[model samples]
Target: MLIIATYDVCTTTAAGRKRLRRVAKVCESIGQRVQHSVFECTVTDMQFEELERKLLAEIDQTKDNLRFYRITEPVDLRVKQYGCFRAIDFNAPLIV
Candidate 1:
């Protein structure tokens, strides 16, 4: 499967960049980075899980906080529409 992982640093500090570089190295070994914080990975289900585990561990080793979004598809219709609008679509419309 093809996976897209996007991560954002909470702050633009030296520690943050260091952490990002570590994570980027791990991703680079497994796949290619197509954007500043986004990686395009071709992995099997098991590989994907392992990658997630490694990323979490790497994040824990850093002082900076981080957020990530992982999706199996490149084109997520819902995200394409609502992500730009800062709108979310939950089963309950009120959640948005």
Candidate 2:
């Protein structure tokens, strides 16, 4: 499944900044960043569970906002994109 993870971490404090970096690191390990605070992750059910757990641990519920969106299959039909930033096609064969 494809998971879209987005986060808004309060950066008014040093701790908040640190949490933001930690959150980004976790997402980067499993997915490609689509925007400054948005990531596109392709993972299995088990991986999603673990990812969610890690994210939940890094965020402060009182100060941060986190979300996960599961994109149904036939993703091309569900997601539309424009501009120069083209997302990688996970199903395509790797040339390098």
Candidate 3:
């Protein structure tokens, strides 16, 4: 499945800043970042669950927001992009 992950982490406190970095690090390991706080990930059901769990842990329920948009169709068939950030094709090879 194609999953779009976006997060808003509080930066007003030291702990909040730490959580922000942790969330970004976890997402970066399993997905491609398209925006500063949004990511495009291609993951299996189990992978998705684990990713969700990891992300949920880094956020304070009352002070942060995290969204996961599950795209049911093929990614390229549904996504739109503009400017310098290239659109992501999950089925294609991603050279790091």
Candidate 4:
């Protein structure tokens, strides 16, 4: 499945800033960043669970906001793109 992860971590304090970086790192490990605070991840059920768990550990519930959007199959019908920032097609053949 395709997961869209978005986060907003308070950066008013040193610890909050650290949490922000940690959260970004967790998302970066499993997905492609489409925006400064948004990521597109293609992961299995188990992987999704683990990813959520790890993110939960890094964020301070009192200060940060995190969200996940599950994009179902037939993604082409669900997502529309514009401009120059093209998203990677996970199903495409690898060239490297």
Candidate with top lDDT is: 2
lDDT score at residue 16, model 1, on the 0-100 scale: 70
Error of 2 at 53 (Å): 0.1
**2 against 4, candidate with superior lDDT:** 2
Q: Give all TM-scores, in the order shown.
A: 0.59, 0.97, 0.89, 0.96
Clashes of 2: 0
- By lDDT, the candidates rank as 2, 4, 3, 1
- Model 2, runs deviating above 4 Å: none
Residue range with the least summed lDDT across 10 consecutive positions in model 4? 75-84
Q: Write the per-residue lDDT of candidate 3 for residues 1-96, one digit (tens) a residue.
A: 889999999999999999999999999999999999999899999999999999998899899999999998755678878798785566779899
Question: What lDDT is reached at residue 31 by model 2?
Answer: 98
Model 4, runs deviating above 4 Å: none
Looking at candidate 3, what is the lDDT of residue 53? 98
Model 1: lDDT to the true structure: 0.64
**Model 3 TM:** 0.89
Which pairs clash (backbone N, Cα, C closer than 3 Å) in model 2?
A: none
Report the C-alpha lDDT of model 1 over 16-67, residue by residue, as the tens digit: 7777788888888777666677776767789988888888877743454444
Error of 1 at 77 (Å): 11
Alpha-carbon lDDT of model 4: 0.96
**Model 1 Cα shift for residue 5 (angstroms):** 1.0
Ranking by TM-score: 2, 4, 3, 1
